[model samples]
Target: MGNSVLVFAEVKDGRVKKVALEMLSEGKKMAEKLGGDLSAVLMGSGIESLAEQLGQYGADKVYVADNEVLKDYTCDAYAKVMADLIKANEPAIVLYGATILGKDLSPRVAARVETGLASDCTDIGLDDDGKFTATRPMFAGKAYVDLSFTDSKPNMASVRPNALPVSPPDESKKAEVVKVDVNISPDDIRTTVKEVMKTAGEKPDLTEAEVIVSGGRGMKGPENFKLIEDLADVLGATVGASRAAVDAGWRTVDDQVGQTGKVVSPNLYIACGISGAIQHLAGMSTSKYIVAVNKDSEAPIFQKADYGIVDDLLKVVPVLTEEIKKLKAEG
Candidate 1:
């Protein structure tokens, strides 16, 4: 097997996703450590122009599988193309961003290639002998485990979004693009995407947001979520909700953050009136900086927060929002 590292650069709405760039940056480091080149694969229609952006991030080579059938993501077509590429190239390492698409696609491709996959990895590295090792949270973030692939030709791992830092692009860099001809027909895909319904508002996806402001039972009711939203707006952060808030019907399930919901690692996490439960902490404990606001000083969230405010959220959030707005105005 070749020692090169291949990254699956996922695209959305004609633009390369940020996590894909993060993988490219990380993959570049891994490739160098392994004494090989870093390459990327892009699978989408009318996405040939995006290869240059991949090169700017650090891809030495880019494989483009552009076809109309591949316009929208389908389990059958994407998995077939990715698996075929792995078989043909036989890279030593394969990296994927643990986004919704990555979570769905990586396992399918690994299964087809008959390889072991480490899912939702927070960190990955190579041993002295260049063996791939991945670190993943277990048992609701209470523990972490390190895993290594055994005799797998292409050691596969899906890394969580925002787990790694993205490197700045070098515009001078360019990649050697190779076009792959997709042979799949409409009949090959069993499921069809009849329509895609998008949620309202331009809020960043919870998993990928750099900053998050979350609410819990202290939020009181659904109407009170406006405070969380206002704070998030001033900070340019996404709004998240603890399971308590969701269970209380104060927020939608999509906004829930806990063991039963989406796992997120952001640069900053603001917990307003959230008394940290183990299940709630499991999802966001990895955030770079945590600030907890709750009336109860004995709240469990204070134990994990880098900063804490012991006050009523209803009284504090509005002041916090106004203060942040003032700071922005002054700047």
Candidate 2:
């Protein structure tokens, strides 16, 4: 295999996802360490324009698979293209962002290429011998394990979003673009995407949000979530909920953050009224900073929280929001 690193640059709403750029930034470092080239692949219709942005981030080469059949995400089409590309250019390391699309696409491609994949990795690097190593959470965040690929041609790992920082792009850089021919017919795809409907909200996805303000059963009723929303709005943060809040129908499942829900690692995670169950902590234990608010001073969340507030969220949240609003106004 060639000592090159390849990154799958995922795109959403005509823009490259931040995590993809982050992977490319890290991929560049890996490529330099391996004394090889850093490449990226963009797959979607009318996405050729995005290849230049990838190059600026660090991709020495950009592979474009732009076709009508590849417009929407399909397991068969994407998997086939990715597997074929890997087979054509045997890179030493392959990186994918552990987003919803990456989570689904990486496993299929790995199976097609007959390689083992480490998923939801928080860290990745090369050992002194130039072997790829990945660190991933285990046992519900209670432990972490480092994995190394053995007997695999290309080391593959799906890194979690926000796990790595994105380096600034260099506008002077340009990438050599390669367009892949779409050979698959409609018969290859079993599913059809007729229409795509998106939820109407300006808030970012829970998994990708930088700041999250979450509430639990202590919010009392669904209507009481207004407090959480108020705080989230003032802070320009996404609103999240514990499983109990979702179970009580106070928030939608998309807003739920826990073991049974979405895993998130935002910069600032403010938990209000959540008791911080192990299952919940498992999902967000990797957050950069965690602040828990609960009336019960002995809540389990305090054990894991960087800062704890022993007070009623109903009163504390509104005051906190007003204080932030005042601070913003003063600034």
lDDT against the true structure, each candidate: 0.93, 0.93
- C-alpha positional error of residue 14 in candidate 2 after TM-score superposition, expressed in Å: 0.4
Q: Give the TM-score of candidate 2.
A: 0.97
| Model 1: lDDT to the true structure | 0.93
State residue 199's C-alpha deviation in candidate 1, in Å: 0.4
Name the regions of candidate 1 deviating beyond 4 angstroms: none
In the range 1-331, model 1's lDDT, one tens digit per residue, is: 9999999999988999999999999899999999999999999999999999999999999999999999999999999999999999999999999999999999999999999999999999988987899999999889899999889779999998888989999999999999998999888899998998888878779998999999998888889989999999999999999998998888889999989998999999999988899999999998889999999999999999999999999999999999999999999
lDDT for residue 248 in candidate 2, whole number 0-100: 91
What is candidate 2's CA lDDT for residue 33? 93
TM-score of each: 0.98, 0.97
> By summed lDDT, which 10 consecutive residues of candidate 2 come out lowest?
196-205
Backbone atom clashes (below 3 Å) for every candidate: 0, 0
Clashes in predicted model 1: 0
* lDDT (tens digit, per residue) of candidate 2 on 1-331: 9999999999899999999999999999999999999999999999999999999999999999999899999989999999999999999999999999999999999999999999999999988988899999999889999999998878999999999999999999999999999889888898899998898788879898889999998889998889999999999999999999999988999999988899998889999989999989988999989999999999999998999889999989999999999999999
